[model samples]
Target: MGTDNRIQTIEESTVYGLYHHGELIYVGCTTLALKRRLCFHRSDASKGNDAPIYGYIRKHVDAPKEDLEIRALDYDTEAAALQDLGHKTLNAQAADGAEYEGYDWTSEEIDVLEEESLNEASKRLDASFNQCRRAAMKLGLIDGDGAYTRVDWSVWDEALGTMSDPKLAEKIGCSVANVNERRRAKGIEAYQSRLSDDKVRAIWTRYHALEEATYASVAECFNVSKGTVARIIRKETYQDVERPPRITIEVAKRYHAQKDKSTDKGRILA
Candidate 1:
């Protein structure tokens, strides 16, 4: 079929092709209005996306919009669009009508990631540990020995002595084994949460007193994990701390069900 260049009105839920200098370069399907989807493509490209299509768009960014001849067709799904477009364009991966797997990090992004702790970098850059590590190695920022050069264990003694190996490992962005090896060398025991006995008793009291007081909320309030709050409620760790009388555990259990149901409903709505 020949390219249709006369259409000016772009409707919703269609497949579109972006052509530059009469050469087909990219094919995409969007449930949003075609005009809005095209705007998004331009925006992402301007923001330095690493995809082939975005890279092409960046090259022609200063040119007139009509230069990239957008052709749209009414298509039900991306697979249908791919079948029609003949899979010859520059798509980063196969589109089975779901979220794209994997991402390509820019060199600048990897450089910034290498400066932060593993956990901090992962959250800040929205890249996994393995992803950051791989990008660093690919950019020649780290040596091929697989050893992370960013961590400094000299100042980690206090944390190593007080926190659990797993928790410390997560906070400092290293492996649990590494934390364990360091702690054992210093003759430190496993983490016993440093929350005081008074704080422990307060967590139990708050859980039974408030209908909205979940293990999570109580933990956040006291700066501890939900698991630690559960252990407190069950009198597992702080057996010395006593619960206030007439406070039934069944109340907390009922609220837990309510919280879980609301969370699930929110996910479905989203």
Candidate 2:
């Protein structure tokens, strides 16, 4: 970043103002969709986000929802007229009953905490995600349940033996350590590249000579992606290696003379 020239205020939705007990906690200017902007704050509020606004909120009630009312601040001609009842949790200096001082939570705060997620709670409490997560877990707010997709180990075994663990992990959405662990568990050894550049070039030449060869097919044979094949072709590193365009299905059928005999439409020759 030379000067962070990115545009702000995208003329989209945004927060006009945030209110707690009719007092302005924080103000935001945005260009995101109003619904989306509101959703973001509502979501963060629900998650316990620790951004300055939520931190300000934590001082008063530990949760914003109790005295919190989300309204378009533009509707109020003189918002200052709304009473600031001086709720103690809203008291910036009060450390005795606030989350900043002790773990003990007010019933209103606890109610908010229970309603919102750990991430939201963390925001309200101005604590870490882990801190909120642990508290939520302890409080039985979260029911541990996750659906996991099963990987095809048979296909993985084939690829694992030919490709790097990191590559396999990228393809499988698993960690490199997990890939290694799985390999070890399955008694499969780590992959070692035996082919030299010359050998690879030779394979590429031979594969292109065959009628069935295509970028995707060749890439699969070479244990790489199609882009790698395309890049090698573009570099012209393999001179006089004729990489022909893929045969269209229509062209193939016409060349083979598979005529639609029911109609008088006969095949054409190259």
Please write out the lDDT profile of model 1 over residues 1-270, one tens digit for every residue: 542221111122456776777877777775444444455676688798899888877775466255566667567666776676756778775576533234455545555665875556777887787666544443344432323334587778767647677678767756677787776665444566456656766688778867777999988988889988887776655453456556455565666678889999999999
Q: Pick the candidate with the highest lDDT.
A: 1
Per residue, candidate 2 scores C-alpha lDDT tens digits across 38-80 of 4456557557777655555555655543465544444222222
What Cα-based lDDT does every candidate model obtain? 0.63, 0.48
Q: After superposition, which runs of candidate 1 have C-alpha atoms over 4 Å from their true positions?
A: 1-12, 60-64, 84-87, 98-270
Alpha-carbon lDDT of model 1: 0.63
Clashing residue pair totals per candidate (backbone < 3 A): 0, 16
